[model samples]
Structure formats: C-alpha cells, structure tokens
Target: MPEHEAGGSLATPAHEVRDFLRRRREQIAQRWADEPLFRTVFTASRDEAVEAGKAVVDALARVADAQQVEDPDAAGFSAVREQLARMGAARSRAGLSNTQVSSELAALWPPAENLLVAESDQASPEELRAWSTTLSVLLGTLRLVAMQTALSETQSLIDRQRLQLLEVATPVIKLWDGIVAVPLIGTLDSARSQVVMETLLNAVVDQHARFAILDITGVPTVDSLVAQHLMKTVAAARLMGAECVVSGIRPAIAQTMVHLGLDLGTVKTRASLADALGHCLHELGTNIVNAAPDGAGRR
Candidate 1:
C-alpha cells in the first residue's frame, strides 16, 4: 500500500498465486534443494535434503494460502511464523551461522518467482511489475522474521549456558543430614558472592540444614572485599536458620587475617572440610567409629 502503484489494483496475493505454488511445488522443492547455499547450510543427505526442501515449499503454500505476505502477524499467517521460528532455531542448533541463513533465504526467491511467473496469466508489464514488487516485499518481510527469530533463539541458548555456568560455579552439596557444604574456589567477586549466598541459603532451606560449611580451600587470597562477601554469606545463612562454619583456613590466609585485624566474629572456623564435617557430625549427635581397626566401614 505504498505510493508506487502504476494504474493497477493494489491487492493481496490472489488465489492464483497459491495455485501456481501448488502446481509447481515439486519443481520449487527440487530447485530449493539444489541451491548451493541451501545444501551447504542444511547439510542433509540427498533424499532427505530434497524432502526438507519440499517441507519449505509446504510452508510457503500456507503463507500463500493465508495471503498475509505483507502482514506477518495476521492470524492466518501465525502458522507460517511458527514454521519460520522453528526453522530458525533448528538451523541455529545445527551450527549454521546467521550469514548462511540470510544467504539461503535470499536464494529461495529466484526459484519461487520463476515458478509463479511461468504459471501466472499476468503477461502485461503492469501485471509483471505488480507481481515482482509484491514478491520482493514479501521476501523482505520473510527475511526480517526469519533473522529476528534466529537471533532470539541464539540469545536464549546463550542465556541458558550462562545460567548453567552460574549453577556449576556455586554448587551446594549435602554432606549429611542437617549439614550442607558450599565449596568456594578462586576469586570472590560481587556477582559470584551473590550466587553463593543464594545457593547456600536455598540449600539450607531445602535440606533443613542446621549447619552450612563455606569451604575456601582453593581461594587464592583474601581482601577486605572478600571478607565482607564471606561475612554477608554467613549473615544470610544465619537468617535462613543455619549456622555458617567457614573452613580451609590455610596458614597463609590465617596470618593474613590476623595481620589485617579481620575479625570473623562469632562465626565458627575450621582448617579442613574433613574437620568441618566431623565437627558438624559431632554436633548433630552422630559419630564415626573404627570397625575392628581394619578396612571395615564405620558402624
């Protein structure tokens, strides 16, 4: 509905367009499969690739059926939008780059137009112009939806990976009944500290844990910021009804703490995870005894 009309009716794609697509559907499928870029991006076996190409033609038929070429959000075009979104996400998981998707989408226009032009009764210049201009606009709309859907799906994948890494970095392990351990490694930044606090507090609530051990054995060094983060974690755990016991106080770390006058206050401290777990077990009225002083397990 632009100002470029040339004395012809400006209307949607007529039923004849759908008929053209249906009559030459097989030819469109074969040509789409044969496109070099399409073959490269889809990377399927010969028959399967052609079949996949045919599936694309099927989607195009639906779009033609709906006649919402210029209006992607139209109710009738919802199926086509879903098809495009699924294709975009599938291609992204297949390791196809954004550029390859664009190239293949552009490649589809030629074969589709050829089929339509051959079967169309619009032999006049005005008719030809209308068909060409309309098809061009439709292709542009399709490209926009396809690319945006692919980008959105890719961003979702990235966000999922980001969350997985966050979970992995702040794992909470249940050492025993009423005892959970959160092992800290490397540097303590504000972001990781927050993740740690949330994970520990959640574990305490989930397990009804009375004592949560925060082990910093692999921590490289301790700064005022690191101390503040640890204190915050302890405070948060206490609020969740779980006492915090910090372990893995290496000799160097102990010396640094004393030199800096870093008072951990009334928070319990231990030298190793084994010691912390032993203390936790002892406080919980659970004890481990040697069996026959041999390799037998504790009773």
Candidate 2:
C-alpha cells in the first residue's frame, strides 16, 4: 500500500497498527513486566514471557485488521478469543489469582496507548483514533475471556475436591473374615448417601464380604430425610448379595424414628458399631475372646 506521504502517516489503520506493533513490541513487554503483578511473578520463564508478549502483539495486530469487518464476539475474532481463553486458563493453573490476572491485564492498556502515541505519532488523526478504539475493544474482549476462564477453572477445581472428599468420607473397611463396615460419621445427605451406597456395594464385591454394617453413630440427627438415606444404602448393599446392619441409634434418634413411623422393617439395628461387628462374627459361628498367655493359663 502507498504511504500518506504528507506527514509520513501510514496508508491505513491496519498498516499503522502493524507498524507500531513491530517497532515497539519490546517496550510493551517491558512495561508489563514493570507492573507489580509481573514484578513479583507467578509467571512462566523469561523466554516464555517474551514469546507470549510477541504472540499478544500479533493477536492485537490481527484485531485491528478485523475491527471493521467483525466484532470481538463474531466469527472473525473467534481464533484470537480462543487464544486468549487458553492464556487465561494457563495463567490460573500457574497459580495466578484473579487479582493478579486482572492487574496484569489492566496494566496492558496504558503501555498499548503509549505505544501508539510514541511510535505512531505521525499517523493521520482519524487512523490513530480508529486504531486506539480497536485496541481497546480487543483488550476488553480479552479481559472478559479471562474472567470466564477463571470461573470455569475454579468450578473444575471445586468439583475435583468434592470428589476427593467423597472418596475419603465413605470408606468400607473389612472388619472380619467376611464382614465389612461402612462407619459413616456425618449427617447423611442424598449426595453422600449415593457415595456410601457405591462404596459399600463395591467393597462387598471386591472383598467377598458376607455382611456389611451401616454404622451411623456419628450422625447428629435422624430426621426422615436421613432415615431415607440409610435405607437406600442398606438396599444397595442387599442388592449386591451382602446383608446390611444399621448401627449407632442414639436414644433421641430412636425416639425420632419411632415418632416418624419409619418402617425400617426387618433391617437389623445395633446400638453401636462394636455390637454390629460382634453380631457379624456370631452369624459366622465364631466369637472373639482374648487368648491367655501360654505360661499364665488358668493361674
């Protein structure tokens, strides 16, 4: 394209943007590094940072070229938008908090404006204005993309933690030769109960246990809701061919269950976890007793 030739302005806005990006890319990155967020780091290596800065400049140049042809949300800008999203997620996973990411992104606007002012000073007034506006819109789009990535990644992390807690909370221990006990401590909600059911059933199959105990001694209350959860877990265990015994019925909880007319019919109940395990051994025709020492027998 031909030059403006009057005041040494570029022929078009795109040309002007490309010229500034090529000339002042280093200054933009240096400015970003001076920001407090980058100065302290949660950043990648120096080479990675420099490469990322160059990619950003290239992305912005593309944005300027497409400004008149498309908006940030439109198909024309999808590639750059996706690139920014990846960048956002990468930043989050690298241990940058939302505040740090925001600070760095917000810090970008000033250096960008400075780049245009210092490097493109001789551009036509209209072309300069268009370029600035285009950059602002693209930067704003990137900011929004970053926020969305943060939200999505945060939610993912929460889900993983919840799954981990479920695995830890519901453990089925093999208590005897053919007995397993699932000693539930907290209040049993529907979600937790599902985990309990799955754990109990899997243990029954895996351990070849003949009896399973659903001990709820640590449960704080026995409302109808909680009673239902217990019943579901028991049913799941029986379906897997192992008998289930409910344990840890406090006086108050028993009273509540009776008052609520919960027909836990035919499901054996024990006052404590020890009672449940003892009963399991009894059904197997064996009872545990402390063995006297060889020398002190009958003394």
Candidate 3:
C-alpha cells in the first residue's frame, strides 16, 4: 500500500476528514459573504481572504488530528487538543450564535453524528449513537465559533487596508525646494484634520522640508475648530523649525475666519502660492521681475 493510504488506515479516515474540512471552509466563506452583519462589518481584499481561509483550514486540520488520535500521549496530540480548547473558549467569548455553530458543523461533518457512530469500531450501537450525537453537536458549535473568529480577523485586515487606501488616495505634494503643500479639498472634520496633521508631520520629517503650505481655497466654510486645527499645524511646524504659509483663502473663508473671532495673528497668509513665493523671495532679499502677473519670473 502507498505510504499515504497506509497512514490513513492507522488514523481517522484521512480523505473523508480532509474533504469534510474543505467543504466546511467553503460553507463558512459563503455564509460569511451572505451574512448582513458580516458584509457590513468586514470587507477583506482577495489576498487577505485567501490567507484567512488557509489559516482556518490549518487550524481545522489540527483539530481533526486531535479527534482521530487514539492515544492521549500521541505525538503533538495533547498540544493540538489544547489549542482546540482554547479556540473553543475564544469563540464562546466572541458570542457566536448556536445556529451559526450548527451550520458550520454540518459543513465540516455532513451527517456528522451518523458518521461518528458508524466510524467507532469498539462502541456498541446504542453507546456509539449517543456519543456520536453529543459529540456531533459540540463539534458543530466549535466549527461555527472558529469560522466567526476567522471572519473577525478578515474584517480587521480589510479595515486596515481601507485606512491605507484613504491615506494613499489623498494628494499631499512635496516640492523639491523644501516646501510641502497640503490642499484641503473638502470639509475638515476633526478626524480628517488629525490625519492631515500626521501626514504633514511625517512628510515634513521625511523630506526635511523647511516650509509648509496649507491652501484652503477648496474648503467651503471654516468653523472655529477648523481654524484651531490650522493653528495647531502652524505651531507644530514651528516646533520642527519649519515655517507654515497659509494660502488660497477665498473671501468667504476669510469672512468666516473673522466671524469666528479666531486669531491667525501668528500665521503667515498669502493670497496665492505665487504671492507666498514672492513673500518668501522678499524675505530672502531676492528680486523677481518681468514675471507672470503673479510675479513668477526672474528679475
């Protein structure tokens, strides 16, 4: 007999066990995809989903091995059993429903109780049937719990990716001449403002920029909170020995700034990037003439 076939005979029904586990994984994946809560709560990328599936399968294989082990002291059997128990406890704590557990078990061990009874060589029919039914129910519950955990983990990965996408999609430009321009294109909520601050800070440090420009022409309105965030950014830039120049202040935003009784007294403001550049040049005692109307040309 082939080594694999020989090994199979000494252990649990290996082919049947593997087939059952594969089916269970598929069922769980389908159910997770269909579930409203799961859909709303979790959304993983293709790679993440595949990796999570593999992890679930690997864990299930260990559990299957432990269940098939005849001797308590079989190599690595105790550890496998302990791991399964811990998994059970964790699932229970996670609050997976009993129905979910039963469905998962049905996938893992189709006609599971009957199979358990039929597989036992030593137990009498009555004893095997009883034990089989009880074990089958427990197994089903554990399977559901395990799948729920996998779902949670997959969802976490998706959330992280979503955050990364947000960061990547936001346009933050760093010029070669040590100027970082962050254009606020929409509403500035506290959360987004904080993200802006972090992005600017990291970019400034990474590029070793000596100047930062925050252009808010795209912003529709400004509240006191938004003004405060801008001030905070200015202060943070100062701390890093970088000057912050505010630009693109539309009349409406300017009016809102004044209405809020906010003081941008310490912040340097310019009508446009060109204006800011001119101011920078003037501060450095350089002259530019015959330039574009915005004074973009050399003297």
Best by TM-score: 2
Window of ten residues with lowest summed lDDT in model 3: 1-10
lDDT (Cα) of model 3: 0.60
In angstroms, give how far residue 278 of model 1 lies from its true place: 13
lDDT of each: 0.76, 0.72, 0.60
Q: TM-score for all predictions?
A: 0.59, 0.70, 0.45
TM-score for candidate 2, please give it.
Answer: 0.70
Candidate that would win on lDDT: 1
Off by over 4 Å in 3: 1-106, 116-133, 159-178, 184-210, 216-227, 248-265, 269-288, 291-299
lDDT of 1 by residue, 54-148 (tens): 66666555665666666555454444565567666666567778887777688788888887677765466556656666666566667877787
Q: Candidate 2: where are CA atoms >4 Å away? A: 1-23, 42-48, 64-97, 119-130, 185-192, 206-208, 218-226, 250-263, 284-299
Query: Model 3: per-residue lDDT, tens digit, 211-261?
Result: 888888777888888888899988998899888888989887788778888
Clashes in predicted model 2? 0
Candidate 1 RMSD to the real structure = 6.8
lDDT of 2 at 110: 83
